[model samples]
Target: MLRQGVSTRPARAGQACRGRPVPFSGSRLRSSTACGAAEVAEAPAAAPAAPQGLGDLPNVVSVLRARGLVQEITAAEELEAAAGAGRLSVYCGFDPTADSLHLGNLLGIVVLAWFQRCGHEPVALLGGATGRVGDPSGRSTERPVLSEEQIEGNVSAIGALLRSVLLRNSPPGAPPVRVLNNLDWFGPMSFLAFLREVGKFARVGTMMAKDSVRTRMESEQGISFTEFTYQLLQGYDFVHLCREHGVRVQIGGSDQWGNITAGTDLIRRLLGGEGKEPPACYGLTFPLLVDSEGRKFGKSVGGAIWLSAERLSPYKFYQYLFQVTDADVIKLLKMLTFLPLSEVDALQAAMGQPGYVPNTAQRRLAEEVTRFVHGEEGLAQAIKATEALKPGAATQLDAATLETVAGDAPSAALPRAAVEGALLADVMATVKLQPSKSAARKLIKGGGVYLNNAKVGEELYKLAPADLIDGRMLLLAAGKKNKMLIRIQD
Candidate 1:
């Protein structure tokens, strides 16, 4: 027989609502609230009543499925009915395996936002404890364990990022998002206590049957006992959240299906007694972000597309989305952004029309996603850098703009004498933009060399003091794609 928590049907049906859904016009949810320690307090003692215009908001499950966000949900009918009935506390856990979250981690946060928009509560859980054990859901080899100190640092950084992003995206008067660390509970409990309380309920046969566990055991680098016990740790997280904070739904990527079911099953075994009713906890998942070739998305030749501006600049993030293929843009627009379905459909339709400009949809996707992740100021910075760096574009290449684009391009320092009154070909050869002066002359003659975004047509063109932007730096482009920055040094 199927497990208590496993569902045979997909949650793709768009359940009807009383009225039209709320379109997430960015202005409605943009707030300047400070996300600090004070806001991370326990969820309010009583669940807040659904906002006054509840009828006007569509069921959150329907909204998610419409946007291609739902993969599989346990007890789909019951979960949908519960969502339509009243406010639900939905959560998604993020393990602090890295210092910053990347594009692959964005869907969970976006799902949380949708729940919040529909007037439900959203909880962001940081897996401070689980990071030490490591999840083996999608891996063939065991993960290298991190030290407690490293885990703690990662937890704090990821917690702050979640708080800021969630708070900024919350609608006005929305309940504040609760940022939690599982270590808070796991730290105090002794291993013996854990074995008695949690381990007793999990059957070895059942655990072995899990896809995550089965696949690893059959591989050459077999799973470790530490990794094998990860599901139990994650399961207990759901139980604690449900009992303490009234959280009822757990959301994650599709790879988490085994772990998520473990939570639901654990809840049923531990909390559902013969004389009592079944616990209302459930699990949901979204498809992993990947490209047409089945390789993971959110990665570039450089590295992961990070959500933190410190790790990857907003300009680079925006550029990555702006370069997405037409085949993927429409799906991403629906899944990633809060743009209305009708609007997304219009963009898709425009792509087939004769007057449609290429990359128009991509630009919109880039702008909306950048605004969500980095906010208005960051979006502006990205757009400015994009404009300033375009070869032969009219936007002035000033020092500030070049500084912003410098993070994504190769750069070097040149002596003032090397640039001032020097032949352009010689400078290009010096910077390795061309293999030799002869090659540089050939490229310049082909009108493929640009100095400060202006095309340099003459093979013998010489650099002037005026050629340097603000007499400090100059942007050099070998073509539309390859660019470098040269800073003048005395």
Candidate 2:
């Protein structure tokens, strides 16, 4: 029940789009895109369609359940009816708590894509307003309020990410995903107006009963009135989207049940009670994606696996997915990828067969997800990176690819003069590769030191100009898996 956001140093400005290159004279390595305002890769011309296996199925719930996407539903029959009813307008909201949406938000956006393929309309809501107060649903402590400018910046970057991932590969005439910011509506209303209109309909007793509030109230840090009233804001968002955009359904992660149900209840009380014919508002939630130990599975040992290649490089992103345990690959494939069920079953079957490789399943999951988020070009770049770091790739690697690899790996800087004609032992000592010159000498003599993926057997060898990839940096390794980038400062 930790709060969703973490403060990270802003990725420096030298990293810009691959198409629009930014000249770098900085210490940290950078990708082709600007880290702060990362660009989305353009999608291919074609789009994937609904499976032929789903022909005339009554609803997509069966699909979701088989895929492990559905955790809770407010109205099972009504949800089925909406899916079967043709061209439903539905949405899932994402708060701009971070500059980019992380792995946790993957299920929500993928659900939206599934609806679009089913020929329904999907809307993506950026919480320009709700993000300000912060979501308390999954937290044990109070969320620190964010500034207007900070939230707004997060809103724009996340909007671009959703659009790139969701709007690609439409079947013949599918509607493009409609993106909205909650602040567009919430910004205009005064505090007194919100209290008189939205807040007036809420019940203090029911609000107090919500698990998020109940848990927080009993904690050392009691709930704030601002957070307690957050339900009203979310409910109003549903009402506004429904009334203004013709959106009829809301979907989200399971932690959102209280807030989601609050919206449906508001719709029923405010709209259906007024003699509205259909009473069409609905809410559905999927279980939060978790691992075998039941911990949420998106954050890596490093941090949240961000969708942006600029934030989390495609190579690291692919490696993260490629490393999922055999126990979790099937469930993750069902949740994160759009592979047909038949293909998923084959991969699952392979996991149980004799001499079958788990890497096959892990590799498939990595390829599908990498292509989806980073595009085919990004996937190719990731594959090239995977090759560059392999056992025998040293001599064949090019400068730009080496730069991309350095951009993804841990890196440090040194004056060029320090590296020129410097002994391997001193270089290792300077980069913290070893505790001291003695330790560096011992490691080099013991066959533990590798320069640019090639083992170094010499303790007193001087680095030649050719040892620097692109004549700019030295790739250092203390062992098979321990590596670092040394960027030579001009």
Candidate 3:
């Protein structure tokens, strides 16, 4: 089943720095080494001032509204006043259906980062308990249940990813982010006690009216009792956080409006008391990340645009942003990057001006976002790999660089004997670069074939030991776009 809102699929641990805390300033990002622990550094001596026009917005809510990050918010004025008055602890939930989060889940992290930048405590709640029941918000069928082992493993991996991304680059004196598992609270609760303390407050008629429940009930597949009660489980999470952790705000995607409100309502009923004042809790939602064509933003032809470098390399991730349409790039820069709105406006204005270079905005968007997700070192590697792998570019190709590029490209492995002195056409066909040997030769004769980004003029050329970069890998290109990496084994 397709998990929506807070739920994410399992992802493996990628090449992310483990255990080390990297400092983040609101105005600028720091660099981190690839795969190794990054050293903690002092905040910059003179950080850039807040972007122009941000001065007019007094609180994080206004900042979010200005950046198109706010879709729906509860008690906007009161929340604004509270945020401006003092730091409020805010939380967003993530269900560990997968090991790594994809592009779809990014806005939540971005929103949390915005809160951090605005001087509020950000809490990331892992749905270790909720993942079992699954969120029914965007589903048409019941979710396949995961074993406890799968759930626990996912929680650990996602928690690591969360810490790596969220804890890094925090503003000075910002509260360190707290990653909590719902299971910590839910695991020990008795079923009868839950029904008495939490379930009693939820009205079944009101619950059935939720879009998630209503939609499922209308479907031929229909909703199950377990899935129907998911909102109550989620709503109680907010109550638990509020009473125990001082968390006062909950945020999520627009699809999660019901779940978010459920939590708010639960807080009001269970904790607000019979007083004239409003409950000290709120819910906010952001528009789902999508393109001009209305297609979801994070998916590619290959698969979900994963946040983990192990699932997808920084180069591939960078390329994805670099290729976004002109229609979408500017908006993305505003929503995804911490770049000043003034700079974003400048980029948007440049898009229609004369003498404008193609993809300048896209390149900047790619670099900024790559750095945010992968760090400075990851961005540098992406750039170097991008430049080195450009078709027919003069940059030298080395085995290390080619291996980085190979992470996102089609590749095959063959014995060193099979590749040495082998006919180029046969090798190309062997790697499935072409439909067959005849097709490979035909492409070669037409001057569309390349070896390590160089044009190949001979249809009968043979692979040589020297052709292998660092004596291990070779890059073959069928024209500019279709490329393959062949690794030789002894």
Output the number of the lDDT-best candidate.
1
- lDDT string for model 3 (1-490, tens) is 1111112111211222232223223312112123322222222224443332234335899889989999988888988877776666699999988888998898999999898778676888889878878999988899988887888788888888888788665665554577777765565556676787888899999999999999999999999898899999899999877655567899999999999999999988887667744347889999999999999989988999999888888989999999999999988998999899999999999989999999999999999888888888889888989987776766688886787787677889999999999999999888889989999999999999989888999989998999998999888889988888889899
Let me know the TM-score candidate 2 reaches against the reference structure. 0.80
Give the TM-score of each candidate: 0.84, 0.80, 0.81
Candidate 3 wrong stretches, greater than 4 Å = 1-58, 274-279, 407-412, 421-451, 454-466, 477-482
Worst 10 residues of 3 by lDDT: 1-10
Off by over 4 Å in 2: 1-58, 169-172, 403-414, 418-467, 476-484
Q: What is the Cα-based lDDT of residue 30 in candidate 1?
A: 16
Candidate 2, residues 443-488: lDDT per residue as tens digits?
9999988888788898887998889988897778888767788888
Poorest lDDT segment (10 consecutive residues) of candidate 1: 8-17
Tell me how candidate 3 scores on lDDT.
Answer: 0.81
The candidates, ranked best first by lDDT, are 1, 3, 2
Clashes of each: 0, 6, 12
TM-score attained by model 1: 0.84
